[model samples]
Target chain A: MPRSIPDQSKFAPGLTLQLDADQLHAFFPLLQKGVAVPATVGCTLKCLLCDQFSIPADYVTDRITTIFMDNRPVDDLEHTIIQDGSRVTLSAAMPGLVGATMRRGGFYAALRQGISHVSGGAAAADQHGTVRIKLFNLLLAELGPLVLARGLILEPAELADLLKSIPDRPLDSSPGTSRVLLTVRFNE
Target chain B: MDKIARIDMGAAGGPKVTVGDLGEYAGLGGRAMTSLVVAAEVHPLAHPLGAENKLVISPGMLSGTTGSMTGRLSVGCKSPLTGTIKESNAGGQAAQVLARLGYAAVILEGKPEGDDLYKIVINKDGIQVIVDNSLKLMDNYPLVAKLRQEYGDKAAYMSIGSAGERKLLAASIACTDPELRPTRHCGRGGVGAVMGAKRVKAIILDDAGMKMRPPKDPDAYRDANRKFVEGLRKHPVTGEGLPAYGTNVLTNVLNEAGGYPTNNFKSGQFADSAKLSGETQAALEISRGGSATHGCHRGCVIQCSGIYNDKDGNYVTKQPEYETVWSHGGHCGISNLDTVAKLDYIDDNIGVDTIEMGVTIGVAMDAGLAEFGDDAAAIRLMEEVAKGTPLGRVLGSGAAITGKVFGVERVPVVKDQALPAYDPRAIQGIGVTYATTTQGADHTAGYAIATNILKVGGDVDPLKTEGQIELSRNLQIATAAIDSTGMCLFIAFAIMDQPETFQALLDMLGSFHGITMTGDDVVALGKKVLSAERDFNARAGFTKHHDRLPRFFYNEPIAPHNQTFLMKDEELDEVFNW
Candidate 1:
């Protein structure tokens, strides 16, 4: 009974990115700081300007297929970075859910939820909140018994930490302080 | 040939089912009478997993209908999970066959000896107690095959997986459809484990060529059913939404609404959520070249079934749904659609509760036992559970066991079962349903169907439990009466929203019984069922104290929306008042 919502009620969570493909400079600073900019241009803005606005995970940038904000899935958003200077826009729709009818949002929405979770001290540092902290646990669910068939849970825990320790950052924000935006192209 | 009979195994003649007053309790639509049986026989407080238990499965009021989903049945008993009077409905041909042969609900009285297995098979003959050693250590998949080979697919089957065989409180009772796919289950609550405790491995029912003239008004019945189907087809929620997105359609919607429970009950969100959502599952289907929906039973107008495929479009499984996807995907922390889909395929075919298993695995992972998003491990563990290995036994034990093993105090389970998709902390109305329903923490029990059978006052705010008691009570009642009719609970969805549909149902029932009844009777029937269950629960040892949610929900705050399960205990207790 996950989505057992009552009738005529609308209380959902998501972030809709409304930006102009022509206004890259306008968004660069705010995007770099990873802050939300208010104002909507339109739902489907097919602008004729030969410009590009990159929907980064956090930091501002262009020319990336995915923007990984936390562990939210970003590859599912409709994108085509091939249209030209003509611009290829990709808004990263993210993930965060538990009950039924679970869906995906954008990078900003997932980031907002995670930061909010961490700030509220709901994840307990160790718990990682049910969102990000959960991927580690669910993956363990997929792997624990088999690992136990061979050894213990702590054995894999150490391995996960060791693997996470390998840095892939480009020295921007403090790695622990804020997650770096990844501008990854699926096939470029 | 041996006479088809039974061997009483508990207490004197094994805790006797009070068969007084009424005889021939057989074929009495498993859902309806199952409630009454639990009400009469089981002492509510007598620990759900303890000896003083009675598990009953009855067919619907009208089963065996090439009857669009009329072949459904119900399993009722005191829930070891919620410690409340409980009943779970499922789709299969067994109830139809068993009923066609004239047995209403098969009351499984007392407990069994050891883990030795037995089965109850009914055919042109009668009820036969067979030694079920052939499929003793097998999961539902292989077990179904073996049973079909022996009894033929013409016989409907109901069985449990290693999860149930292990007596996990989260275990579900699996049933086979016309397709022989054991995708349908009387899930939610540890009813299967109860059967497992009864030492029954499977229940094979074969009416073969038996004829059953269900009480129906020829033209009127047809008209009512037609209208019901039409209404289902017309509503956006039932028709387009469910069929298009299937139940997973709500994934993105639920996540957006902040009601989704990401990991256990710690948060109401997921990061890699889209990767495993209904939309994602649908995407996987399109990419992998598979179906997006199918029917749980034949002739289902709302065919929300899907063909989960491997990367190469090879047939993996069917009926990959919102619960399974969420539990394996978000709940277990895996954002991989294909991986979770594979696990769902394996679980469904094997006949396990994916949500329970996923939640259990998630809890285990939370205990630092494993990492989330491990596809190979999930597949391997699911396989082990199917194989009935010792590790599988532990895996099958579910979330409560994982919490116990890890010493995690934030276990969000009521009774002994894992909570479904909604975090009670987020949806306080559901918390009341979890806290008060006879079935422990089951959402389906009181998932109010618009305004169908019973009416409740006020619009219950999702986050608040203001009118939840009256709402839940009315739902519980209407739900019970509906189950007796052998209709899909989704039919309740129609009843809740459309008055005509509800009126049609009553009209059809009246036509069959040749009586004119008003809405007041619906209320009365619902009250009767609730009172019956309450009386049994009270006798069984359930004080007002048992009618409660777990403690951590109140103490902890779930983030994103930052709310806790804040319903007062007095409010919860008020739900049980007749």
Candidate 2:
């Protein structure tokens, strides 16, 4: 809940994303928003930072301090596998001992030997689908706006429920929101 | 500026007070001052609750100054909880006020020889040890309110509650914050038990006539203080994230890393972590007419603490930290934020350590005293502690005693102190600290999380055993030094990442004292403090075998990642070698 946010659609100012029930179902997985990331299950489990996703070179070092795949700390990102449906998470630097202990390929990796992810078996066939992504702490402020503008895969019911919870609070009233511009694009 | 106040509670005629020069304790402050006093003056093998065990209270080196985030007070004693020398520090107005009154430390020696409780008052006028039996068994909130009415709200207060009066091992010393709310606490290892043993209900400090301690070099000190404040403001952790979300922000981050220590350490991940997370808690506080960002003391620039209001938009308690949330919420399988907040208020009011109390409840649940996730049952247990019932006494003795009383074998403890929010099996560097720290399983002793997860100092692989000893060692030393300075520990994030910030802290001290200080001097001070603590523990019969996690941490593999504590005994033994 600390880092949960609806992905905003990018567009001109004063514009909002309004979609019909049928249209909402056709475009995105709105019902599973925040509850689950209904990404493609798995044809194969690939190494996270290797060939699974094309992450920028500096993203691991500069962007993300903590990484998690399938609720397990991905301290060694190059070795940790990301299956199709794996819930992947990224966050900027955090406080306390757990934060230091979870860094990817960090010097203290030896401390977590029993829990370190170890990849096994050959790579699976290439496929296109979805994977759960969560941003937290400083990463939410740094990349949230950009990710929101790019549009997020969400379940419509979750969004509706969120809006109903606090009718007075605007969707754009989070920590670092100067302006909120939204546009809904249908897949079909 | 160089005085120590000694109170002899068991004096032949009656309680008496003596003021003397600092002597051997000239340059010490905070943990260093307290630990050195306990280590030197008190007998190691004496019963912690007996007359021979003394309690030493002192402010940090930079306390009572113009420095940012430097209002922490340290309380040290032979801990009834851990049976080791303990130094617990907290942020409140007491440190600054106590220092301004021109005393380096207040040493309470010997035990009172009666059932009657007393109160001690100190001001510019003199010391007053009053036999006020009317203050018996009062809780922290009402006790402070009564004190405020009698002594005025301008005085800083430190007091005990029913839990402390009952001599419960989980009892904490309550220190009123700037707003005169008894929300800040020295909440570890039962320093309140020792205070209770001394038969003193409260120590009121009135510094109405005192001014801020003058600096030796005013201009240099001002420049250094400005640079230090600027450094904190520029850093992301201190300047933005903490101010926006407070310490509970760690709930989500730890949950994501699979090291959140849920269900009483049976699992690493909690299903309902988000409900008790910092973001949701912040929004709830804001919506309920409470603030999401506030300072515990006057000079705190980071403002990581906040105010939490209840459903009716009335003040309830300070924002619960991540450890409190995890201990009472995720670890017990309770997800309701309101429940956690209410629990926090109850703990603060009754002057109990929230972490110790919550963990005790979790252990009781494991023993079938109540079901896990039973929010009402948890609240009832805390209420019982407030009333000091027979069952409540056992519950208030902390997790180790509760686990033993209930025949629960999965007690997560080292040296009888409860392990905090982090699962050591998942984050092994913390395991090393928990196992080897002189103060038992305290997370703040050496917070490796900064490097392992936050990447502030340097990245350390949390899951591996290599470099763990060194990481815990360096952090323990650095943390000892910082705790001495009375600066908020959160500053380490910025200082570790930015070298100049670290220099600025040293420069502030140097400018204030009119001396040239180098990084080596800080390291030396840290080494001295740790050595004193280690020596105290050693004299108290602690051997290398005492420095170990419970057997279950090695035998049982936590879920999600299915990991066990992998550090070998030999490696753990080498932690304090340097």
Cα lDDT tens digits, model 1, B438-542, are: 666666766445432354443343222344555566556666566677777666545655788777777666655556756666556556666777777677677
State which candidate has the highest lDDT: 2
Query: Which docking category, incorrect, acceptable, medium or high, applies to candidate 1?
Result: incorrect
Please tell me which predicted candidate would have the highest DockQ against the true structure: 2
**RMSD of candidates 1 onward, in order:** 13.2, 6.4
lDDT string for model 2 (B1-578, tens) is 57999999988777899999999999778998999999999899989989999999999888888889899999999999999999998998999998888888999999878787889999998788888888899999999999999999899999999888889999999999989999999999999989999999999999999888888998998898998999999876788878988988888877766778887888888877777878778878987999989999999999998889988999989999988988999999999988999999989988889999988889988998889999999999888888889889999999999998989999988899999998887777789999999999999998532232223234444344557777888778778877887778888777766777777888989988889987767767778999999999999999999999999999999877788888899999987887
Model 2 B-chain TM: 0.97
Model 1 per-residue lDDT tens digits across residues A94-115: 1111221111221112212221
Could you estimate the TM-score for every candidate? 0.72, 0.88
TM-score (C-alpha, index-matched) for candidate 1: 0.72
lDDT of 1 at B321: 70
- Model 2: lDDT equals 0.79
Query: Which 10-residue window of candidate 2 chain B scores lowest in summed lDDT?
Result: B448-457
